[model samples]
Target: MKKNKNLLEVPNINSSDAQLKKIIYKVEDNIFNRFFNSFSKSEYLCVCSGGTTSSCARDNFITLDLRKEYDHIHLEKEKNLIKIGGGVIMKDLMNFLGSQNKIFPTGLSKLPGAGYLLTGGISPLSRRYGLAIDNIETIKGYLGNGTFISLEKNNLSSDQKLLWEGFKGAAPFLAIITEIGLKTFQAHPIQIIEGFINDNELSKIINLAEGFPENLSLQWIYAQDIYIYILAEIRNDLDKEITKKYLNKLENFSSLKIKTYENYNQINFFPKELDLFELNKNNHSEVISLLGEDLKERIQIFIKCMKEIIRSKPNNSCYVASQQLGGKTKEIDPKSSFFIHRKSTWKPWIYASWKKDDLKEKEIVLNWMNESWEKLKIFFPKIHLAQIHNHLNSHEEEVYLSFEERLSELKTLKNICDPESILPPL
Candidate 1:
């Protein structure tokens, strides 16, 4: 296959574990081992299927492409578990699971790799099944030091347990995940309710979300024109009656545009392609806000701040979006993984884009996003790691916030497994 010029190319690894180890030894001896003495000589990146939303998969690094080596998806019907390679995309996995009448909470976007799970994947089905990271059973990966490790949650040593915890929501910094085993659930029919709602109905939307059943998920996107595009997913017919009963309340405020799907394929979840602009590598600005107890009040502030940012946007493509995160996602034990934003009911984020060659426009958008974030952050202090890439803001601080109380432990794991800092810095 012809490689994309925008991406880094590496030799394909199509061999057994023994041969793979020899390749790793050779590569380490020739390149990675040298990083210990000269950290600035060359940067290294682990690109798994190239689905990263960030520019971390650029040509500047010595990229280790895992797509060719690990792109298999195996379903074990007896065990009710599915083993997915790091290279597998959301669409491929969803299709395979849907074929077997099974499902796993994963992101709606089709491009993101299993790396999405490492950042606390919030899916349309998450309200019932919990975050993707919560379903993980085993992780097999190579550390920055070229050591291959396989860990199971059911059986772990003290040190292994710590590393596992760090890997759950912060895997990029810890290792290159080759494959993972996750628990699966039975697939169910879905009902999609979508429409444009005026700003006045924002509070009613929040009220509906507060009482949402576990089988329902809500997503609201604030467009550049100030209209709120609301999309909701109802899991199955079992909850269809109650779901419609609550949705009926939305009709009082929103103009309805409802649709239904028997399975995942019928629903359109892919993002629209922007032809004129691209994500600004140096100036891309984004911030995730975790809504507190005052949902309605905080959402009002969020909408106002987003409107201000949108009005002053350097480009017409920039907008704000949010995902509901309160049902089964909130029930997961905070201590189980590094992702600790479970108490949050909503995750609102700001995104800024610019013309490919317009440096001035990039700067303006970045400044506006940052300034707007500062004004709105008072209402929601916590952050989600998935949407907040390293280049967007204070990289280290964002990593610190994602890990929060477990920062020290994660750092210690980094020291032990990646002593040379061969991998990209968080």
Candidate 2:
């Protein structure tokens, strides 16, 4: 079960190769109780960390290509903090957070799985420090009843009541979260603007980025051309030349142009010399996170969920992105299971990642993103809450609710932590 062209490798297993499988060799300490009871019957005992992300406590776990178990270890980081090795790999945690000049809300291609971008919420300074599971304050590893605690973020609700068992997007089945104490930042060092447009002043550049403010950090990519990234957070040094007057106000309101400015701490943010994680693009992309609050009824619930995602494709393309939940992301308190969108407005995704094995055309792109969340429940009386599996064709996984009690406590926490559901094959 060890195959890899490059799911983005970041190995570590030595002691002179004492047969490393699905890695988690914690240098003795009572042999971590025989590797946690041989990983509770091993249906999938992964710790695979290197972008594509893994540590499947049981998603029927299968990801064993430990790059012949590479033994490249060298740890040490500071400037706010970092302590990696949950199989580390977003371009080696951006060359160790740009050698501690620091930065961490990760994503924007350094290859995914910075713990699948902080336990699958979102990042890239998620509208400036919000999700990345609340900038995790600690993690440490091994669980499946073989115990080895150390969670943090004020004891993730008593460690999800002594270790999460499963469901609503089962945190890959809780535990093997090894070494993720991140929470760093301070690398702005000035300059980082990008632009390109194909036409249609994209609704007055999304209305001057919804009336820009809060030290700007904007994006709106339609891929293949129609991208715009303007991020500025100089923290004085003479306002770093006011980012060239915001790149001359995005070249006087768009029409295709300019790119690059350097100093997002000098780029090279990861995607190591090519080989993009062996692109076997079996299509995937359907993320929605607009917790609603009438932006003209969220643009009429996005044109009625864009006519069911343009009839679920005949070559489709989508990506909405508004981002900015207000300084420090709604200052927590949405019930705080790390990040349950206290007011998450704008984050539409819906891609069409080609590579069909025709499982009914990938269930018509997940049934057209579950019929755009059932036409966003006819603008669900202007929604307000709901988290975890943030709607990607919902079985409605909750973290805190409002959509009628997160679909009945996410179906009783998936019938008491995955009653035989073995997750995966989503």
- Give the root-mean-square deviation of each candidate in angstroms: 5.6, 20.1
Predicted candidate 2, C-alpha RMSD: 20.1
In angstroms, give how far residue 322 of model 2 lies from its true place: 14
Candidate 1 per-residue lDDT, tens place, 1-426, comes to: 334433333211110100111112122334546544544544445344544454334334434555666779999899999998877777788889888987777765666777688778877777777888999999988787878899998999987887888888878777778889999987667767665666667666766677777776677766543333334444546577887787677676646566767765546552444222234333333344444333664667666666676677666656676777778878888888888877877777676666545678778877876776676567657767774354555566667666788888888888877777777666
What would the per-residue lDDT of candidate 2 be over residues 1-426, giving only the tens digit for each residue?
335322223321111112334343343355334443454443434444452421222232334322233323243443375666555656666666676666666655564443453443444356556666666666665444344656655556753642332211234444445566666776765345555554355445554555554456555544333455556666675555655665676776544444443335345421324322223333433343444432442543454455444545533333333333444565665544423435644444433433344566556656655555456544432222222242233533323323343344444544444333332211
- Highest lDDT model number: 1
The 10-residue segment with the lowest total lDDT in model 2: 10-19
- Show pairs that collide, candidate 1: none
Give each model a TM-score.
Answer: 0.86, 0.30
Clashes per model (N, Cα, C within 3 A): 0, 3
